[model samples]
Target: MGPTLATRLADWIDELGLTDHLAAAGLPSFTRDASGAPSWIEADGEPLSDERLAELDASLRDHGDDPAHGVPVALVLLARKARLRAELLATPAWTYDHLAEVRGASLNATRFWVHKQAEEHHLLTVAQGEHLLVPAFQLTPSGDVRPELLPVLEPLLAAGTDPWDAWIWLTQPAGLLGGDVPERLAADPEEAALVAHAATRLAQRVTASPKPRPRPAPSPVPPASGGCGCGGHH
Candidate 1:
C-alpha cells in the first residue's frame, strides 16, 4: 500500500526544514492516531486530544476583536506551513473547497490561509470567482492554467510556435484533423519534418517577443493617527 497523504506531507515538511518552525510554535512534529487523523504534541509532550484540537480549530474561524480568543499566532503560522506542504504535493489543479474538504476547515478560513501562503511562496496563483477557489498559473477572468502547465508551455513556447497551438496540436490525436496540416503531417515522414520545422519557427517568434515590465511593489500603509495606540505609549 502507498503512504498516506499526511505522511507524505510530513516527509515534505521535514525536507523543507519546517519542523523547527513547528517546534518553536510548541506543536508536535507530526502524529497520527490509529484512525490516521493528524494531531500535534503539546509543549509538555502530551498529545492534544482531537476534541481539544477541534476547539482550537474552531477558535481560528472566529473573527472576534479579542486577540486572545483565537488560536496562538504561532500555531496559525504552523498550520499555514502544513497547508502549503500539502498543496505542493497535491495535483496541479485543486480548488479552495477541495483543499478545505481535505483539511477539514471552513472554506473562508482555508481560502484566506491558502492564498496568503501561496502569495508568500509565489508557488501558484489563486483566483476567486462565483464563490469558487480556483488555482492556476495565470490569474484571469475565465480561469488560470494548471500550475503544471506553465513548465510545459514555457518550453514549448521557447522552441518556436504559439504555445497554445503547440499545446493543442501535440495533445490531439494524429488523424483527428482529417486532411488538415497536422493530419497530413502525421501521415508522411517528410510532412512531419516540415511541420516540426514550422513549429520551431513559431517557437522562435514567441521567444523573440518582448516581455512586459513587472509592476512596482505597493507602498506601506501608515500607522493609525492615535498616538501609538498601545499601552506602551506615554
Candidate 2:
C-alpha cells in the first residue's frame, strides 16, 4: 500500500524543509509509528492516530457529495487547480479569427462556426475569468486542426469530459502509450492508432463511472463576450 496521508504529511513537512520549523516549535522530530503512520501532529505521539485518520477518511467519503465537506482541503484543491489553469492558459492558443484564417473561412463568420464546433465536441474550449480560449495544442503549427486530435477527441468529447479535464488527460502520460504523453504522441504518425485507442478507453471509463457529478461553482461574474485576443486581431 502507498504511504498513508498522515505519513506523507510528515514527509512533506520534511521535504519542504519545514522540519526546522517543527523543531523550533518544540515538537519532536517527525517520525513514523510502527505501522508507518506519522507520530501524530500533537498529543505527543498520536495526533492523527489510525482511529482519527479512519474517522476523517470515512467522513470525507460519506460526504463526498457535499461541497462544504472539507473546507480546507477544498481550498487547497482549488488553489492547485488555479495554478494548473494559469499554466495551461499560458501556452499558445488560437482565436476564432486566427482559426478562420488558417482554414480559409470568413473571418467575420468564425465566431459562429467555432462555437458550433465546440457544441459538437469537435473543438475544445476553455472559459477563463473573462475569455474563451482554444489552446493551440489542438492545431498544427500551420494552424490547421491536427488530424490525430480529431478521432481521439471524438470519444472523449462525446463522453462529456470537461474541457479542462480532457486537456489534463491528453497532456498526461498514458500507460497505453508506454508512458508517452497523449498530446505529444499525437505528433507521431506511427502512434496515431494507439493514441486513439487509449482515448477511446478513457472515454469508456468516464462514461461507465458511477461517481456523483460535482456541483458546478457559480461564476460570480459573467464571462467576457469576445474570445481571446490570441490572434492579435483584437
Candidate 3:
C-alpha cells in the first residue's frame, strides 16, 4: 500500500490548510494509535474509541474520492459548506420557532413569511440541521426584519446570485463602500443608499461576467496517436 490512511489524511489536512480551522471548530486532531493505525484525540484529551474511528473511516470512504483531482470527496464537501455557514455558524441567529415566539405569531405563519421573504431574497437564511437560521444582523433589535436591508438584498437576489454567496458578500467589508461592511452600511439610512447602489452594480457585474468553470481532470497517461479525445488511449 502507498500511504496509510492516517498518514494520507494528515498530509491532506496540511495541504488544505485546515489545521487551524479544525482546531477552532473543536474537531479531534488525527494521530497514530499505539499499533500505528489511525486515531484521534479530542481537545479534552479524550481519545476517539476504536469503534468510533471505524465508523468515521467508513463514512469517509462512503463519501468517495475524486480520482480526477485525487481529493477525498468528503474534504471538498467540508470545505464547500456554504461559505456563510462556515463563517457565521456561531453568529447570533434565530430559528423559525424562536422568531414566531418573538413575533407573537403562529409558527405556521412565521414559517410562511420567512420562506417567502427568503425566497424573494429579502432575508438571509442559512440551513442548519432541521431548521433554517436567520442571522440577527438582518433583523431589527425588536426581532423584525430590517426593511432597509431588503433593497440591498434585492439586487443580489434578482440577479440569481446564490443566497450563501450573497450572505458572505453582504457581511464582508467592501472596498467600493470605503471598506464598510454592506450589512452594517445598510443599517444607516444615508449609507444604506450607497450600499444598495453598490449591490446593484455588483449584481450587474456578476450577471455580465462568465463564471469560471472547474479545470478539467488530468489524464492518467499520454494518448496513443490520432487526436484521441480523452488524452488517454491506453
The candidate that wins on TM-score is 3
Candidate 2, residues 1-234, lDDT tens digits: the string is 987666655565555445444433333345666765666554244355567655544543353566334333333444455566667767776777667776678866777766777777777877765666677888776655677788888889999887888887787676878898998887788988889899999899989988766545433454467855443312
Q: Tell me the TM-score of each prediction against the true structure.
A: 0.23, 0.56, 0.57
Segments in model 3 whose C-alpha atoms lie over 4 Å from true places: 1-84, 209-234
Candidate RMSDs in Å, in order, are 22.3, 15.0, 13.5
Top candidate on lDDT is 3
Q: Per-residue CA lDDT of candidate 3, range 41-64, in tens?
A: 665666667665545445544643
Runs in model 2 lying further than 4 Å from the true structure: 1-80, 97-106, 211-234
Q: In model 1, how large is the Cα lDDT of residue 160?
A: 47
Candidate 2 vs candidate 3, lDDT winner: 3
Candidates 1 and 2, the one with greater TM-score = 2
Superposed by TM-score, candidate 1 places the C-alpha of residue 218 at a distance from the truth, in angstroms, of 3.1
TM-score of model 2 (CA atoms): 0.56
Q: Count of backbone clashes for each model?
A: 6, 1, 0
Q: Give the winner by TM-score: 2 or 3.
A: 3
Model 1 scores a C-alpha lDDT of: 0.48
The lowest-lDDT stretch of 10 consecutive residues in candidate 3 is 63-72
Error of 2 at 180 (Å): 1.0
| Per-model lDDT | 0.48, 0.67, 0.71
